[model samples]
Target: MRTRAAFGRVGYMAGALALSLGLLGGCSAPSVSTQTGGPAVAPAQDRDALEAQIAEVTQALRALGPGVDPDEAARAARIAVLKPLDWAREWQVVDAPLVHNVKVVNGFREKGVCQDWADAMEIALHAEGFRTLDIHRAIANARNIKLEHATVIVTADGQPWDSGLILDPWRIGQGRLYTARVGEDDRYSWESREAVRAWTREWKARALAQQG
Candidate 1:
């Protein structure tokens, strides 16, 4: 009964300037770039792989057609993303132990591919049985992009969400769901970019990569 938000997807190369000390002032991220400066066009084979997977789940929705389940779509989107994301790795490439450091975790063609893919996955989720909404937490606001998370709300309008049971894939293994609050007293279930950067600095102090 807990309607929640989830985030997924990927894109090609994107570069943004790093600001110091977690301040908001930083060079803007370079426009989306792929090996050829174009979107990383999915190959026929990869598209086919997702096509059927998406189709299978889409076909499963009792109330939907052969291709519409938001939750399933979200699941499919995650599957597509898994081909590129390293859910197994903790730090998806940090830059010299600094927050706002440049670390390219997953982007095949590199156009904020993660965002694009995540969007698509949300569509998939809609095709399934769950109603989904998108949320974007700026990296500048959080520090690390992954740590600077974007999540999906698996509930539709008029559905009440449990402010205490939010789930974030990035911070996996934390059993209880993160509660979301709308006011000043909310403990950040979704951390801010500044917080992520600060955390990065702490990470470097404890366990930073020996080389760049």
Candidate 2:
């Protein structure tokens, strides 16, 4: 009895429901891989490239302020660049990030979502307990449920979150890392995670009052 138009509407609604469920399960917007293949042990050339990046990041961290310790900068740079790559292999990330996230949510895999990477990175950096640096958690597109993303940011001690550098591993997928200033990243507008949580709580409270 249903017309073709009704069938199209049903299909659209089903697709939207899948997307909403995926996002609610801690996945973010789909991401394109910067590299073509899955995670692998860095070959000689890749190791050289990674070392070069570590040095570059170290230099940037040291430039944050005179109070930033050189030793801490080097250590943080190494961990920030290396841990995600290790996790990629551990998570068996053989597909694009969103694909991997679906597998994870469906019980085919364990963890490799954007939030997983962010949480692991934050925990590893926080464990270092650096005296001259601060590790922060941030969310982008927090007001948009479907497009939300989370990341780790690093700043000089006492500097605000926006002044930090974003270390995002999920954006590029396949274990490749992406780094940019919180203000300079072209893809997302960053907000402190704590602020977003507080705002969400207030919004939920208002909704509950309206229903009463």
Candidate 3:
């Protein structure tokens, strides 16, 4: 089966950079203007917290033993996503799109958010060569959608929806990643195929608005 990484390679980076630069739809979210010539103070606490978490994950990987070959990189990336997910909540403004074109900024956020999580995970998992999992951008509803979420859906035998193991790091607060079955979990409302297709239409419309 064709992997999502195959398709996302070119578009992903460009889209992410555009979103980060506040160039999406020519709309800029309110940000702290840096007009001072003084050097910006570093965020020491946040940096320390992130480093500690990475070290913790690295130590866990080491516990797998020297002889045992583990997918250390993938495990590390999964854990690292938590830091950005948590940071996005505080760093990002939860603003509804001024126009459909500008929603990409809200979805992508300044630092990282739900779509960013999914996009990053999708890129990471693909790079890790996970043959059984596919990344899906799952939305909650079809009409008047708000804050659409995303996750990596794990399949048991490389078949879509065969088993629903959702890896969603943005569903809850704190530094924990939320992973669960699609329908069984209350953190997200899983959309059906029809609903997903409809949501895609809306998503594309938003994207087009940015392009125009």
Candidate 4:
């Protein structure tokens, strides 16, 4: 497991969605802003730059093999999505979801959350024309409330049962993101919640420390 510090490298919260959206102007981290859910337009220059990066990553993915390599494509797609999101997060341009503690489903009127990460991933990947994976939102350890964790799931070639990957960038810090087979990685299990309580306790403690 990654150190708690790795998860809270950047601790400040974002402001209103409009203001936070403005942080996208230069792709720098700034305090995030929250508002009724809406898509914020990124600056043209930043968007263009991201587009170029996606194109580059796509080219590299192509070199993997003739047919679409779902794993490779998924990896590349995660990177493509994370790069910009990291920029936004680093600059505080991205809003994080509100968490009162590890147990409550606090209101989202404050900032971004798990849903934000998933939303950003889906939006950016689609914008990049990444078609290798279908995005799905899932809960880890559905049976346990305290350990229930939300994550973004990707199905290879839009097929959930065929091949799947988990694009969980929020698992670590220092602009880190995690990608793994849906049920293969020991990080979390899709079928049955495993170690979710421990993981949540660890992460929540780390988060609280950061806030302190």
lDDT of 4 by residue, 1-212 (tens): 75777555323232333333442222122222233222233456666765665555555444334555655574666464546355444434232322211111223233234445556666666665546545566655544433444566655454643145566544432223455566566645454223445566888899999999
State in Å the error of residue 135, model 2: 0.6
Candidate rank order under TM-score: 2, 4, 3, 1
Query: On residues 1-212, what C-alpha lDDT tens digit does candidate 1 reach at each position?
Result: 33333222211112222223234222222221112221123356665764664454333221223333456545634443343233212223212212213233322222221233335434544554434432222222254442234433332223333221122222121011122232222333344434556887988876656544
Candidate 4 overall Cα lDDT vs. reference? 0.46
- The residue pairs that clash in candidate 2, if any, are none
Residue 137 CA displacement from its true place in model 1, Å? 11
RMSD value for candidate 4:
14.2
lDDT of each: 0.33, 0.81, 0.47, 0.46
**By lDDT: ranked, best first:** 2, 3, 4, 1
Best-matching candidate per lDDT: 2
How many residue pairs clash in model 3?
0
Query: lDDT per residue, candidate 2, 115-191, as tens digits?
Result: 89999999999999999999999998778755578999999999999998888888777667788888898778888
Which stretches of model 4 miss by more than 4 angstroms?
1-66, 69-81, 84-109, 191-212
Error in Å for residue 124 of model 2: 0.7
Cα-based lDDT at residue 95, candidate 2? 67
Off by over 4 Å in 2: 1-37
